[model samples]
Target: MTQATAADAATFAVAVPALGPDVRCHVLQPGRPPLFIEPAGERLLDRAQFRQWSRTVRPALDALILEHGGIVLRGFPTAGTEDFADFIEQFPAFDGGYAGGRAPRETISGRVMEATRLSASVRLAVHSEMAYRRDYPRRIAFFSRKTAEVGGETLITDVRHLAERMDPELAGRLATLGSRTAINFGPRRDADDASYAHMDERGWNQSFHTEDPAEVNRLCAERGLEPVWHEDGSLTVLNALEPFVVHPQTGRKLYRSILHMLPQVENPEQDLERRKRQKYPTGATLGNGERLTDAERAHIDQLCDQTTYSWPWRDGDVMVLDNLQVWHGRNPYQGTRDVQVALLD
Candidate 1:
């Protein structure tokens, strides 16, 4: 039950590309890229073998992940949600639930939930999960239940790397302002779910998992969110967030929510403009409530674009990410893709 380890930290560290600051995607394969460990003889890991891996390699796996920021566990047997949950048990999860959740997710089993219900055509902007909320998960994990025929590859960026490369003034402003955003949830369902879609809007009751308003207020207060009840029987949540968060592991400030709240008007189309009228449309601002300048936005876009890299999804591949160090997003695709997600506090 011996698992492999890198000879030195330099080789194991994610290498930055020579041509550009961007780190190229690591397309994992069988019996290659020493990072992809094949336990149980290059096949799906069996229960007993996985147990041994848990006992022996857990510390090394965590140490490697700490140095690498993220790790992919493939060639491991995960036929369904239960198996995936069992595999996840080896790595200790952070405490807390999805208090300030985004996306339409159905909890399959244990903590495993659907990644997002956003439309297939939508081009997702990269951002850390629950970045705008007061409390966020330290680790984000994804399990690929299905792989698309074409496209549908997830784009991930190492915020740890991007932090040093970002423009200093912008980073300073974000550090001071943190960032603030507001979301207004109307009583009725969002008629337009696709365009400007932020998260699953099943109604406040379902989101809070309670029908009582008093209890809902209590929960909202705990999360540092302001709950405003509209006359039309709708609720609006205003959240004050910091754009740059210090990584728990590295303690370096990393840019966050830039993509989630980049308040640019892409088109003058009716739908896009209509979403603008709503209070809850995703947006970003300085801690002082001043808007980010044009130059700052452009610089952020350049950095974000350069840092993004994607790889095709393979069935049954699971990825564990340090939420504070990496940002994840969805890319448009054809055919079908089924990815289940579970965020551990």
Candidate 2:
């Protein structure tokens, strides 16, 4: 077979023989709408095959994305028991794993691990993982190795949708309030006896720590978060701001902003201070300024809840999402569950 040229590569299309009507592909940008790539039939690409394909097609895949924004990869092999690390490495943007900083007890580190374990209980409320960090991931991917015995479900919310639906007054308030977050990594409580008492604990604190407090202050003042000390001892700082980031290639606003810390709603200051006085370990502060109030807190929660969506687990299903645009969470489940994860810069 002859090698394909740049022009040929630009127009090259991979024949996906195993996608259904329910699976849709979107260009992930504005201007031109998404182009549908219909598969000839349902087909599955195993790990070895996918790896081999990546070796020769990565460059072409990159070019395709440059021209089309994104692609919905379907027909990948899965078994409740297949090794996924190889497949994850083939797709850098869809690697499932954890990046550790604050939490030491349960630092998740690879695609296979993230794929098989239950990170949090399904009944737990929905939240974006690692929202407290300043440089959080911009994309997320999950592969279901097994379905839950009972009520496990995955929910996803398009934050952009929320932004569009937001009341102008509420949006203005949140934009002005910015956000703050305090993370704890120590045991919830010590064991009953001395055996566990006085253990060397670990944790971290993340707030708007910057060289210019005035600038931070100016950004959050209108949000009503003026560095108030909580009865529990922690202090609350807020930053309200927005970036009009335009996708260089697409020339469209990304509209990916949120008050993930939910400072005004959770009021972690008091609890955080109490934990500090208790001598628990902690580290780091990441913020851009902004605070919240009771009213603002309620509004934000309502908005997030309304925008949330879920991806139910199947024994061998892989789900990929635009982290910047989609918010995800887990549903309650029964019995043991396993998951693996990885991240790409």
Candidate 3:
């Protein structure tokens, strides 16, 4: 195929006030929130050129994210964690790190982390990053280093659209009552404890990077988490958070709840079954501690489905999302996938 000329690149470029003229931009899909960006005629694939371009267009990129909610930068030459870290350095870092996050992640480079270590068969529901907490990153970036052989598309949705489509009564209740998240950091068990062998749990020591209970308590306090300690060295924190937030620039109410991801019992019967089998269950509830009804959960799930979009990942593609404005998830896959992440405020 013939390479796109500089003039051809400019012809399809989206308007960015900071950059006088630039390469092409495409919407991820018709009427979708994320705008797609790729080098057309520019040497953005060159490392030095890519860095210079990223720095020069920082302001424009900021504007684009707020206006469009998210954007995908594809066809960039990010071969490893170092390359991804270089690109992330162009933007501000989120200092909080991933200390209290739910994902099983490992540090790949400076402020860059492996996206997740969950089983490929496990499908993740869409959620605003760290929405379960009182404090969360304003922005999150995902860099794709490898693509799965089948499936593994990153699902995204605009929470603003979800808010618009929500049932008025449910919205009213959530807005008024807010919500709470209960995160359990399972206890350490000895080799003799066969009961703990089968459960999937991340120890509190791993979550907080400290074995000292006092230090863990201090960290929890700083994040507005109410910690409850168990005799078996386990910890559970309760976080009361608002279900929605008004976008700083647009002033529109955006749905910020993790209702789609929260663990729930199918019914009262299942609730009894879970209590008998599990000691510390991580889940969410209304501020008043009432379980979300099946109908309410179904309605929220339906609204998310209506607004969701997903596309296959291409190696070296990076997705930047405004955490409050966009919700992200993972689809189950058949082969290997390597996606790294970085957070920004």
**How far off is residue 22 in model 2, in Å?**
16
Badly placed stretches (over 4 Å) of model 2 are 1-47, 52-75, 80-82, 93-124, 187-291
Please report the candidate that would top lDDT against the real structure: 3
lDDT of 1 by residue, 1-345 (tens): 132245422223333232122112232332122233333253225656565554565566566456566677666676677777877776656565654355555567877777766667666777888776778778788889898888888777766757678777767767766777765444644333423344424466645655677877898888888888767666777788767667776778777675334422223364366566665554655657677778777777677787676766688888877787767888877888888887764
Question: What's the CA error at residue 126 for candidate 1, in Å?
Answer: 1.2
List lDDT for all candidates, in order. 0.64, 0.42, 0.76
Candidate 2 per-residue C-alpha lDDT over 144-202 given as tens digits, one digit per residue, 9 for 90 to 100 = 66566766666665554456665677656545544444333233232222111111232
> Could you tell me the lDDT of residue 66 within candidate 3?
85
In candidate 1, the residue pairs with backbone N, CA or C atoms under 3 Å apart (3 or more residues apart, or in different chains) clash, namely 94-345, 177-287, 183-280
Task: Judging by TM-score against the true structure, name the best candidate.
Answer: 3
Steric clash pairs (candidate 3): none
Ranked candidates, highest TM-score first: 3, 1, 2
Error of 1 at 330 (Å): 0.8
Q: Residues 61-153, candidate 3, lDDT per residue (tens digit)?
A: 898888889988888777777888888888888877778676666677779987776667667788888877877888999988888999888
TM-scores vs. true structure, each candidate: 0.81, 0.56, 0.88
